[model samples]
Target: MSQPTSRPTTATRVYLARLKGTAVFDPLGDQVGRVHDVVVVMRLKGAPRAVGLVVEVTGKRRVFVPLTRVTSIDAGAVITTGRLNIRRFEQRPTETLVVGELLDRQVTFRDDSGTATVKDVAMEQQRNRDWHVTKLFVRRAARGGLMGRRGEGLVVDIEDVTGLAVNPAHQGATALLATLEDLKPADLADVLHDLPDTRRLEVAAGLPDDRLADVLEELGEDDRVSIVSGLDVERAADVLEAMEPDDAADLVSELPDAKAAELLERMEPEDAKDVRRLLAYEHLTAGGLMTTEPVILPPEATIATALAHARRQDVTPALAAMLFIVRPPLETPTGRLLGVIHLQRALREPPHELIGAILDKDVEHLLPDDDIGKVTRLLATYNLTALPVVDEDRRLLGAVSVDDVLDNLLPDDWRGADEEITDQAMTRTAHG
Candidate 1:
């Protein structure tokens, strides 16, 4: 097989259904594999474009063959450059398997017609030798069922399809969220950042407060700001309140002065107050990095009570790692700091035992003015995930989490590096 002498016109669209399962021939017309799936790379700002084809070779092993290797698309056959690598196919962060992710998926038309199932994707090879998904062939269910056994099929441009068309075999948003639930906040945030804007917002809107806050905290400043700025004041305030005070303050500080003030005013008085206090501190100081919402329990409270509070759905695992035992006034910026109880101690203690009895009194603490260097030194020296901040009067102020410290310590483009690492790890896990 050789390159086709003539190319198809713009009016001629090759449907994915007809191309899939067809024979693939090498340069000398030797059959090597069969086309199993099409691979495309999605862009944040544009329509996805085909990059390669997943071909099932002998021994039923599938491999990815770049579009550059394909010389021509003929009737029921794909002509290639004659060379094929014998390795299994694995998707990258930028790639999506069209058959696994989009074919037979439900898609909404821009004109608001009822949802239709994707029958095939129409691809047109551009002059640049690139294959782009230009249209979609979708089948809509008929109104009546008994007599109308067939559905209406229409070919529409890819632009007309709303949001990402997920695989029909997979559950929708709920399933997506469930699968992503176990991912670290940073990893999940990376996934969200890669998604199309509309889908990103949709996923963000569906997440509960704690989960959303965690994910937002893990995102870069620009990504976090973009996502939050898109929300209405009420929703934005709600998400901020759900986040650790320091992270929330950092995000709000990036907003325009007027917009930040408006959001703060709309937030709950307590939550707003905590964020405002953090905002007042220098960005590199302990006060700026500390969260005002660490798990605080009264000195008289029992282990059971502390454990129960820690177990609350609203409390994040990071925050629940330790409990700060304070005197009379239980809230932060209150009575003298007493001691701290690690979760391990709380769990091993008797249910009714007072937290005061198990307090680890020699706790290393920090003052609001302490710099990031000092904070990091103290945390690393003590091997601590959180360290309490105290006032001149030794009143408990807030606690800085290790995550915040690391955020400041790492290079500015840490998020990009993290995303790459996470993607590679996930790809390995998927293939294995």
Candidate 2:
């Protein structure tokens, strides 16, 4: 959260807008996950009662943690018992995703003081140890305003707002998105998945190209397709261009042939060319799975140059794990493949040393037709995070990361590994 608040005092009223993305810690002072969103039970005549939290654990899997298990909610963290359910979270029929559903609601002050968009909702603990959304921080304008003015803002009891139940025909995402601006792409994708189509598209449109591309890669295929389809062709093309060549190709492959062709036509030629090349191969094969943008350096490059390339933020950790050594034309499908250099070896060598002198020439190559089984075996056997794929001429084409292999290998619902909760501490686990 905010660095342990510099001290540990419980908050009387917690604003969920601030709680999104906060750290969820076990009592032993170990972090287990993050607060993705608050789950609430919406009432007909009154405010929604806080049910629990949707905490995203490792592996991007989310589980429900009952508020009853929440020992404290301070400015910094939500401390809980170490015991937790390992099962996946499924929204109950009567539950509402407060962060998604309640925020940004266009509401009228009960006294008719004027309307405002809900910026954040505050929950207070009751005598019975229950929690309810008793207050709201709202703005007199849409976000600041439709014309971008610095609108009046205020915090008042929830009973003072009349439109809490109104589902506006159109809603602004700026405020809600701002609250979640720090979320990782995967976590953001989860939030988007739970939102209605219109809000999801609104939020998606607000994200920068690169950020949206990353989320697209993490979304379920159906959601990905739905979001992409909802966008006009040009926007879809831009998003695809921002993705890795292999990922872009996979997304395009999911579309109808004509639509895919149109998107490819609109993309920048160089990016389109790489994706088209990848599309030429069958799924699960080396060419299909490998990203065309792997680090490709010539033998003549210095160890220093290789290290510099590895340090670039654009290069993924898996891609940087191994450097593909080639003869000339460092781009994929370049000159004949020469050897490979492990990043560790590069670190040990003098910066001035030639990469060629220390290259691992014995490294095996994966052909375009090599299946995923072979890719997995090779990566696992050598303890390698990435492996090179090459053309028949032994020219470097691309490299496949272990993550890519896992994506193809896992079941469609792998993100939510749905095992029932086994922890005895969660015997009273909230509805899945």
Candidate 3:
């Protein structure tokens, strides 16, 4: 992590209905729970400000996850920081539940137009990191319910609609930020990069930490540097912590030593510790390129748990292709590196079997100083998607995946080159 300027990014506008029951993932992308509702604090003047989400985790217990702790929110999943307050959620007098209380309520157009039932509400984040209710989706009552089409639905700005509470009001509309809800990080980064700096930073300020980190990674280095410099040091650190350790380490290396040191200290100990270790290694070395984050289990774990961990979508396919087995501590620098259970074999074994029983002990591990060439040859020879890196004592440091190797192998400007190739192909497609 390094002190940054600003995180230039696209604003994420999430509709309330789509978020309900969506999987809530942790910093590592493992599903922690499902979103049950969004909590907001109603205001006197502007749209209600969002506070956080009510997520239902283990034991059917609902807990509060604040917007500041949220890393990304999309239809597929809402990712948050690993830290959470597990205490049961209790609604206060000032708090509003968007999913529980607002949907289907009748609202009036502030201008005294007509009324429509609230179908959905959109919350948008701003440059200051605060979330505000920005839009509402409403439908006019169906004139022909059984025989004909239902009422028309339109996206409307929040100011045009009245009533956070259930009240009889008309729903006339105005278009807001409905189009930005579905953009991929790369596509969204392009859009943000083209915007004026002020607007770009404003949107970036509002994005979830992990999402902003992704968009920043897609931008050119100059733009990336400018944006990071714009963010406050604390927030800059948060974004970096949300990023993959290797990416974070690379970005941190680009900063002034003093700033980098300060920002790393500001990061969570677990996250900062990994990046610090990465910083000690050569950028192209196996230890530097490999992510410290990967599925690790102790010897006592079973195939059922291992398989479930492997099936998670958050971990990249390469990382998921093998599970590292260690001694006592499950975290990286994990106890003596025993072996890896390849996903292909794990799939065929009975779920009840112990993972230690099937562990493939023959795989040779790489030392931290191992060159990229060695990593490539080992992976190629074994036909492995990833290979473990270890200390002299055979303690697991991390695992290097195929993509990490290729990313470093490619030219530094490969992303720009890729775009050029794509544009040329599109031009040919048009003429052909």
Give the alpha carbon lDDT tens digit for every residue of 267-348 in model 3.
8787899899999999768888888978898878899889877765346789999999999777888899889999999999
**Which segments of model 1 are wrong by more than 4 Å?**
1-184, 418-432
Candidate 3 RMSD computed on C-alpha atoms after optimal superposition onto the true structure: 12.3
Angstrom error of the Cα, residue 128, model 1: value is: 50
Per-residue CA lDDT of model 1 for 147-220, tens digit only, reads 33357777777888775543433235545665565577788999998988877876776564456888998888
lDDT of 3: 0.76
Q: What's the lDDT for residue 24 in model 2?
A: 94
> How does candidate 1 fare on TM-score?
0.55
Report the number of the highest-lDDT candidate: 2
Q: Which stretches in model 2 have alpha-carbon errors above 4 Å?
A: 1-171, 420-432
Worst 10 residues of 2 by lDDT: 423-432
Q: Give the range where candidate 1 is weakest over 10 consecutive residues by summed lDDT.
A: 1-10
Which portions of model 3 show Cα errors greater than 4 Å?
A: 1-180, 190-199, 418-432
